[model samples]
Target: MTLFSLVATHADLDLETVGILSSGAADVAGSVDVPAVTLATCNRLEIYAEASSDDPAALEASREELIDAVAETSGVDRDTIASTFRTLVEDDAVSHLFQVGAGLDSAVIGEREIAGQVRKSLADAQNAGTVSGHLTRLFETATRTAKDVGARTALGSRGRSIVSVSLDIAGDMRGDGAAFYRDACVVLIGTGAYAGTSLAQLQERGVRDIAVFSGSGRAEQFVAERGAAARALKMEELSEAFSAADVIIGCSGGNRQITAQEIRTLAGIGPEGREKDLTVIDLALSHDFTPEVADLPGVELITLESVKMAAPAETEDSLEQAREVVDAAVQEYLTERQQRSADDAIVALRRHTQSVLDAEMEKVRKQHGCTAAAEEVEFAVRRIVRKLLHTPTVRARELAAEGRTEDYVQALQDIFGLEVEPRERPEREQPAKRRRAEEFTPAELAQMAAHLQKVPDGGFCPHHRPGEFAVERLEVAQRLTQAQAS
Candidate 1:
């Protein structure tokens, strides 16, 4: 069965739409007799939002329509198509693609944040039951590959982030006095990886007073680990914390956690009745703070997009280096996958060919009896058939490896008369039932070997006898030389 994959970045499309599109593509592929198709998205936000799509009926209808189309065209049941599609998504190819793109194998990178995003996306898909075999395999493999790449490489060993970029931006914002000891109060909203990193950098900048907020239980430990004069608050106390802060940095997993109205409320109050020029940095893909938050009086909302724009040329260069590493890893993975696919096909082909040969030999032996002459004839026939089939079998495999398998497969089917032909109902009626063939015993095998020894030279067989077989010949020659020395 052939397998194909489609990968795209999740920029603006809703999560459910992505899932529906993937399901549709998989269904279409199955209709065309394609065994598997996997749809993978790189953006975490797009994957996460699929579960809460406003149109459930529309989504279900789309899925059913696709499945029905495939079932009608391919003559495969909806259940089988569904199961196979599910299986295909869970395959290794999907995982490798994710690992290669997520900076896990990057040369100079420490972005474990992408890993978290991937995990969350997969989890969402899984929870929604949208993760069929294909997607499940893809995500699992992607996660494992990412983990392996991370462990084996130095990709996640560095510290390059928005916090570092912000430090540089802070340098630009604060001028010469930025690096000096400052008693600034920094309020970090959402205690995720990005927030924690920013907090550490802020501490290094000598911002002694820090307030960290998170919905997760880890927020308290995250605050204590920084060793800054810090306090951890629940997500519910965000508005209260915003009023007493000198600078505000927001990062959260929720879709649009902070709004423009909240920023306005923070701006309206402060010591001496003067509004604070709050710098709000949002690292979440869906955006923690609204774009309108920037319009609030003396408040700045910096998103991932904005940070990317404000980043220096050096940061861009580093990102390029990381991309190169990921590309190399992807190339390596694809090469390995191709080789594995070829190997699996070859092994299965060999087994099928051997089974056919064995059945034919057994039938000939049973008809002709186990006499020496009869056995010789049977052995000769078997040898001749094997010799005749060898080149074609090898050629078919070579064609398969070269991506030209169809002609070779058709040729084999034609030669063997194995192609299924349509028959009339009257012709098919009262067809003789085929009986189960008996297996050969050890004694029968030994007798057949002895009978083969009596076959004439180049008479349905090239070799002289059973002993003349290459393996037997080698053993006999070795024994004769040993006997002569003794």
Candidate 2:
């Protein structure tokens, strides 16, 4: 399966459109014949899906189809869709997801929250039963890539989420430039994760008077859950609060445009008014109002764009390190994922070989009429079969690890007369031994089959041979269920 990524971030879609797209993202993906995950944050919305093939025309058609779907679902125009969306395929898709999970794609690079967001996105898809094997491995790899970026790079160290960065911008825009939101009357828009995060950040910055406006009707519960001295206001109350607010932070995630006409009543307020120079921050992808609202002389506007530019982040060193780490992770994910191609062939070959060994052993038993010598012959033949098969299996895996798997796979098919059809998910089997792991992911099973080779016939006494046979735990038996795959 080919990976497909459709990303709409702060650079493209506004917070509101992103919210709209995300609101029905699952339903849209559920309409397609593939595994998919949609991750929506305060600053970005990304959809990762798997398609049937890697053909350019096919992928392009799928891309347009997805864009049209989002346009219809969110009620946005084609131009907004075209301008704000970026489509990535296969390798680029894998790399881009790693970058995002690592926080490099965020408006505020290296944001720590994105890693958890990535995990949650994958979990949500899994819960919905929408993830296939390839998508599952891709997301599992993404979380690891994020962890590596955080542990091995400076980008993670100096990273901050958009929430904290917006707060910083608010403080900077204040006339005194001394963390002004600490004592200001703050009006926070929206009642989602961003709203909750913004509220917490405002509280951290010492803001006592806070009011929230809910676009999706979740405000009362949100305020009550926090147990703070905060007021939850209806949408209509926004204008009155806008007139009296010292600072406004928008996390309102919905498609409704905050038209300047709605708030035009405050146009004539002078610089000497009670809340002169109203600081309005649009943290949402969709602006709180048309850009013209900032034109009002009495208001100073700040959006995520300004926050990103003014961010006091040390990014150069961290970014380069993160890129290198993601590149390595992409390679690792691809190589390990491709190892499965060799697995089916190896299993079939060994099973075919085992059938021959069993046939020959039965013949020997019949020839010698069940003597001890006949039993010894059966043991000797089994050891020989294992020894003969070991070299090709080990070499194929080594080549797979080097990303040179096709030749080995073709060689096996040619020599053993094997027919291999690639599978997305492995066949689940009940264990023959202990059931420690309830189930294994496709990626894990691939590695287990390739790397954890089983010893011959469970015979620990290799005194008849030149090699030592270590009896690993029964879990090894559970994993080496070649017949299950067959």
Candidate 3:
């Protein structure tokens, strides 16, 4: 299977469109195709799909058809599609996408929430049987790379999110000189990550009356550790706690448990002369409190989405910087991918050569009527080929690592008289066919012009260019120039 990576964002299409595109790619492959496309932002989606074929030409054709099909189906411009994909497969962009998607690039950097999201997406693809061997490796590599980058870099040192910001805002809401711990009662409903964080923030803000309620004893130890009042209550005590609490932070995974009736009941129980003002913070995927609670005489409801907006601008900038880190990582990943691709090609070429050598030796053995010596000849041939190819293979890998894979690959093909189908070429062509003088450096342009002067139509020389060295020489020179310049 040939792997192709694409980058897109969530806003580009609805869930239905995503489904259709995934299903369509799968149909083309005659199997469930897993898209390793990750959502880096509201505007970005990265897709890595694989096409199967033993023949490189057929594979290339199939890939093109798939690209065209996706563009048509999504009603997006082809250039946009290509550009998005280039970012994914290209060295810089791929690394960034992986990092960002992994949540390592989050504003509250290294929050661990992004890792879960990435895992979930991968799980969804796996469950659907869309993840094949190629995609599996790609995703696993990306995940590993993200983990490594996160560990190696200081990007996650001070990552904070809207939750952290909310705590700051909450502290400000309680006026200065009024000790939070002495003045107001803070009730944290639910024992989720966000709730725990909010509770911690409240404590940090000097909130004296901190109460934590969970359906089980899970949070009791945590609350005790924080030296806060804790109670394990059944679902029924929600209204009583709501009535008694001044600030309520709700972060749960279940359905909307705080109903309108519950809010009304809480409001009704408050002192008639001086009504209670309840602040409800809902930080769950499915809201923990009903919107109708906002209409309560003295109740204020804050959804997760709203709180995210209220987060400090600096927090956003931090997240943006984290994203930049991710982008750098993606570029590194792309370079690795290029090297890997070159390695795969070399491996394939070696295998093919070995097969031919084995066949020829076997034929010679049969002709000599010496079956006993067949194994010896086979071993001898294998050693010879390995020795002969070792330097070139090693050089190819080195070039790939140095971002000079094209030269080594071209040289290998030329030397072996190997016909690399179009799909095997790593370079993508530009739409406008600009002249060499405009595109290449003066030296490169002169070299090309010189070489063309020797050919009938400014094409390659068949004899001299037939061997690997010819291609290698040009590529190495180009790479050296680039490296020196850099």
Question: What order do candidates take by TM-score, descending?
Answer: 2, 3, 1
Ordering by lDDT = 2, 3, 1
lDDT of candidate 1 over 1-486, digit per residue (tens)? 222233333333443333333333323433432222323321221121111112455434444454555456445566754443321121343443564336432221344555554565566554544444434444565565556545555444454454566555544564553643275667777776677667777877777778887766667888677665688877666667777666777665554466776666654643333454566666554466767776666565555555445644435544455455555655555454444444444444555667777787678778876779777876787687678657755775576556555555455457654432212123233778743223545455455445435544323344454345433222333343445446
Every model's TM-score: 0.53, 0.72, 0.57
- Please give, for residues 140-226, the per-residue lDDT of candidate 3 as tens digits: 666665565456555455445546655555555645524644567767777865676677666566666666777555667766666
The better candidate by lDDT, 1 or 2, is 2
When 1 and 3 are scored with lDDT, the better candidate is 3
Assess the local accuracy of residue 116 in candidate 2 as a C-alpha lDDT between 0 and 100: 88
Native-referenced Cα lDDT, model 2? 0.74
Best by lDDT: 2
Which candidate number has the best TM-score? 2
Worst 10 residues of 2 by lDDT: 459-468
Residues 1-486, model 2: lDDT tens digits: 467889887666555567666656656665665667878776777888876655577777767767777777777786777667888887788888888899887767788878988898888888777777778878888998999988999888765877888777767767554447667888887886677778887887788889887777778889999986799888777677767788777777466756555545643345343446677788776566667767766677787777767766555777899889998998888777668867766787887898888888888877778888988888888888889989989987888888777777677668877655556676354656654644666667666554434434454542433235555544644456564546
Candidate 1 contains a number of clashing pairs equal to 19
